[model samples]
Target: MTAAAAATADGAAAAARARTAGGGAGPAGAAAAAAASADDDPFLAVAVPPLPRQLSAKVQHAIISADSQLSERLSEQLGLPRPLILELMRFGAVHYCPVMPKAGPNTPMTPEQLAAASAARAGAMARWGPAPKLQVPRRAMEDAPATAGGYARVHLQPKRFPAAHTTDWRRRVLHQGPDCVVVDKPPGVQVSPTVDNVLESVPACTAAALGLPLDSLAGLHRLDAGTSGVVVLGRGGLAFARWWCGLLEARSGGGGSGGGGSSKSGGKSGGGSESGGGSESGGGSESGGRSGGRGPKAGNEAATARAAEAARAVEAAAEAAAATGGAPLRKVYRAATLSPPPLGRMVHHALVGTRRPGEPAHTLMLAVPVEGSAYCELEVVQVKPIALTGAAAEEFGPSAFESDIRLVTGRTHQIRAQLAASGCIVIGDLLYEAVSARAAHEAAAGERAAHEAAASGRGGGGGGADAAASSAAAGDGGGGTAGGEAGAAAAAAASAEAATAAAEAKCGFAVGSAATAWSRAAQADPLRAIGLQAHRLAVYDPERRLGDGAPAAADLGPGWVEFEAGVPWWRA
Candidate 1:
């Protein structure tokens, strides 16, 4: 049977078991039973479906009956591309439990035991020592003569996240300058690559679509994965890129926007956006998020000072920049708020360090989560009504008004967290609202729905979230991680919970955790396009000085340019 078919069969069996356990109750009872079963048997959640075009790839898992060449086995059995499989392994997507998961009429775990087991699993995973390479050799328990990390029936799961994939991201290109590629990014797509799936991101796809090398494009500013709008990417090999970077960094030094920074070169930041928790997803981690870069510690004067100093160090280079061709950039975003925002510039400082005793008079501070830091606060510069139409009109619901927000800095989950904290959550952002980054198993519900319809000849249906994953239109996921030894030996012997070590916890966790079911689901979810869009990027010539009043960008004089990626998800 096709992987999809196998998943269907497995789901049927689970649903049937659920019905039996519930004494043949109603559909709701069956559903609850199925969920209970899923906790015991993860396979009920692993459904292989047809890959959608411009959508993300599905999450997958496999059971290892024996041990052989790891990558070869996955590539051959799952029908996934070998190179892609290799990439998954490198990013820690491919995971394994030496022993089989416990399945078949097991006692249901209580919430306490479940929580404890969950913690244990996470701990084991953390110290879970790096996984083996593609060509590593191994033996099952029966084949081992003791004293080895012996395994008979092992459990394995290799997941690929969902990423918005389009061969023509080039067509979406808003502007292609000498050293910058600005594009109207689509919703549900990451601005740049995340730790798990690098190939499906905005920069990577944009580079592929533009016939440029992968590393050629880099982000100067970021948009949330769910937000759709204008993104400025620096073509690092060119002079313009360096100058722009310097300009951005200098602005960071001089306290965000007050005109523009001199165009120069050399600004440090990138590889990925900042990572951390917020009012959205609180975490159980030491750092609160998966960010590898340093962020200001909320209101920590020393940390924020350190951040400012670093930017100042880059200022000299930027100060030397010609104020003309390399000018400062102005950003504007359009969002549908839960309620009308007070009109005017709203200045938010670091949650603690907005102003310090004996601090300089002209000093400016930012909100927590600086550099995606959970500690700092975000500065939402301006919020005003939009000339509404379409989705924006419908989303406003005759109460709240959608607004155009001018930003001082763009960071991950910044808009959602800030807006939600300000008393208006984005229409669909589960991360900051009741749904915490959204549950990973929610996809399992969708999978079960699809399976039922398919079994009943309804052919499959749609309407659900997907992840950020897969380069190919048709990614292979055939015989499962393929059963190596005898089928009976691998028959749900391992605890299904073993397969789920951790979730890419939406509880404020930024792209870091993988191998867990929720991570795949969260990343794959296109529904995550949380009602925010980067509306415009205005590039002003530093040479054109702004007088007492900051005039309209068009009035900023010659050489100044602005790009607007019509927000299709909201108002135009």
Candidate 2:
């Protein structure tokens, strides 16, 4: 038979096999038959072209040279799949065709045809388009600063801070950690200079101190200028948010102890002593057996040694806490007030009726009256009663006194408002009623002097000055608190009381004489996720000499109010 007849016969046989393997009749079967008929080479028909190397050396070089955007641009230009491009970059391969699984064996391509198709596809995609202008990734890796173990210590110079500031603020190590920092901000210094009149605003101070870039440090918390306290500084953005949330949650009893958002700030900086001996057992079976075997004296001696060691450890821990301001940091303030005894009592009582929502019902307060009303020690402030009359009486009752109160709560108009609300307004407080009395006194005196001087013009000029002086004196009670804003006193007291009350209320308590029930809840519940409540805080005005014997306790009238640090038990 001729070559054409031979080819036709071969194709027909392959078609029959293809039809049988591809199930009866349809597009798949027809295509398979066509494929089978296409290959009928007499000899040397098995060998096919090698796989095409599409992405040429030039193409690869172009990709590498194009800025960082080359990969992205190339993918878009070629319409090639990302996986394929990634595969090429990773494996240095141009094309990938999945190997077909063999079932009953009606394959579309023989080994020879398979080889040819793979080569042709690879070559087509290679040199596809003008390589896209590579776009660079936005995030650039920065050089690590002077850091170790998530802490970066960078020195800041004073010049970098705000201008027109008194005193040279020195440069120091801005201790930056992953979460927070312990910074030593100078007294009367603003943290962020641009933020007008901020006390100990360390943000600008931090940047200047470290000689780093601006806006590098953010003040996590604030400290009053006169009252120094530690402030937390967050490092990166993510860590900042986490640490902030962690603090809020832990203090509020939602988040577990991430670091230390304890209920009380002044308490010892660690967990309270697990009291009641933990377990009450005097001995166990093992102890009994050991005592019997080793003799009683030997067991007793061992126990004694253990107890001694434990005692030593406790002593050591106490010493460490004292040294580092670690555990149980306590403060006692010397204050002065006018109201005598029971009336003088400045109790930050739980709100009168239903607690104001969102307020910590547990109100903590401490009021220590200074002695002599003139001289005292331990940071005592002198307070004098400013007499009131006329309209002032209608405004702020008839009595009010003024003095600076060292407050813990930074609440709104806490001290002044609380004091006034307690029926003892701070002297010279315009918000209350003292201002009107001073005005009345000045007006009366001015009229009397004017009538006397107008008849003769003698001492007439001096009357105006006298009136001004009296008004100024009345506006500012003699020897009153000068430094710090006046509103702060009232704001501080109210805030401290509010914060404490809110805290107490959160533990479910209402103000009443039922002390035992509230006490039990405090001891047992402990504000849910927090720890034990330490003893109520007390403010004591230490005695100072006035050329007499030991200075008598300042007349604070009656019992000074007490406060407590609501500590939380940490669950490790």
Candidate 3:
């Protein structure tokens, strides 16, 4: 045995003897048992206790006092020493909310409205909607500090991430082609590097396992840290990677000939760009802050613009599908939910999420689902789903049903949000399921606050109402969390609660109580695994027709490649 393992064994044995002398095997005895098992396993490393957190997990909030160098203002504004703040910043624990420039009008404003806004000193807007709080890295502010009176939302917190140490990353590789490597991503480990540490991510670890340079593999698409599924990584040099990214760019609205304005970009990153992103808006302010990129230098701006246009198109498709009850689905998903819609029914609902700067404003979408909608939408078509009874249902405890989702529009959290909107919350979806339920309560609180503020004459217009709605101002998804922005909260109208709830009975499993639910959902840890999985993935020729968008296509890809992951953790 290794010296460290031997020492641990000896200590554990000594503890066991002491416990035996006192009474029976107790806590020490449990430790001893674990140690003994570790020794027996050939692969087991020396048991080490979890390290205690050195910094507070509670997120610190602040605003730039004035126009100053961002690094210089950190100590005074956030109340931390300059050196310590610098250390945390280097470790990727510091972030600032990006000031999303208001989108210019999509259509001409009414003259009456313009005159009223001019007279009242209120800025004219397409819609007074959810201003998603997007957090990008400190470098953005360091490079360009805000001007005086600009909303500078600064966030400081310690990033504590669990190490994803696997000796056999090669086993996780699903397809290793000449140009790309597809892998079945595990939950908890990030697809990209977190802000604080880069070595613990899937791409880095996988490259290390394959005896390749750390920068050799770059993710083409990223799954959430909590989500387990298919992840495609670009392999080899810059030329092939560029070609692959360029090829994927042709994909849009499910077709091959590539009509004008139908091309979509995957927002491919190169040159190891350390632009931290996470959360719903997918920017620098990740739930677990992250950054870094791979491959040769290439401008991400064009790709980003294409992605924005694609997002707008998806929003349109989703809204139209919801209104028409169905559309030609492109992605198929099978997930376990608390309540499943009727079998063979083209169950449809619009999914919404706010946008940040550089992102296509939710306001740009031509068709909107909910009233004053300031976000995206998605579609789900006919499905053959069944009850997850027997062991699967038992795993769910109270009740669980299986649903087949064929999405005409695929966006982040599309399935989860649509399911929740249909009153079928996905099992263990930490964010949307609970957030929707909690919205009911938050909107109620905001409405009461607005009434009280208006009655008491504490403020004029939406002054008191906006402040009271700080809680609901929280945008959707992990990245669009409630924290970060102080006094920058957008007023989440009461209608959001109704729209999200769809008047379905609240699932006690998600938010039985508001306080407990807040801790679990709104502030959910990024490392916690959810009950969702990309169980199967099949990409077909853009022109192929399928019955109800089933992904068991005869053509998986250009070469007809297909992939299926292992059983879901919950099912297993």
Q: On a 0 to 1 TM-score scale, where does candidate 1 land against the true structure?
A: 0.46
Q: Please, what are the lDDT tens digits per residue for candidate 1 over residues 118-186?
A: 444344335433354311323211111111121221222222223444324867887776656778887
Error of 3 at 182 (Å): 0.6
In order of listing, the candidates' clash counts read 37, 57, 11
Error of 2 at 228 (Å): 5.1
Query: Candidate 3: deviation at residue 129, Å?
Result: 44
**Residue range 412-432, candidate 3, lDDT tens digits:** 454555555555666666555
Root-mean-square deviation (CA) per prediction: 23.4, 32.7, 18.2
Candidate 2 vs 3: which has more lDDT: 3
Candidate 1: deviation at residue 157, Å? 6.6
- Rank the candidate models, highest lDDT first: 3, 1, 2
Please rank every candidate by TM-score, starting with the best.
3, 1, 2
**TM-score: model 3 vs. ground truth:** 0.48
> What 10-residue stretch in candidate 3 is worst by lDDT?
281-290
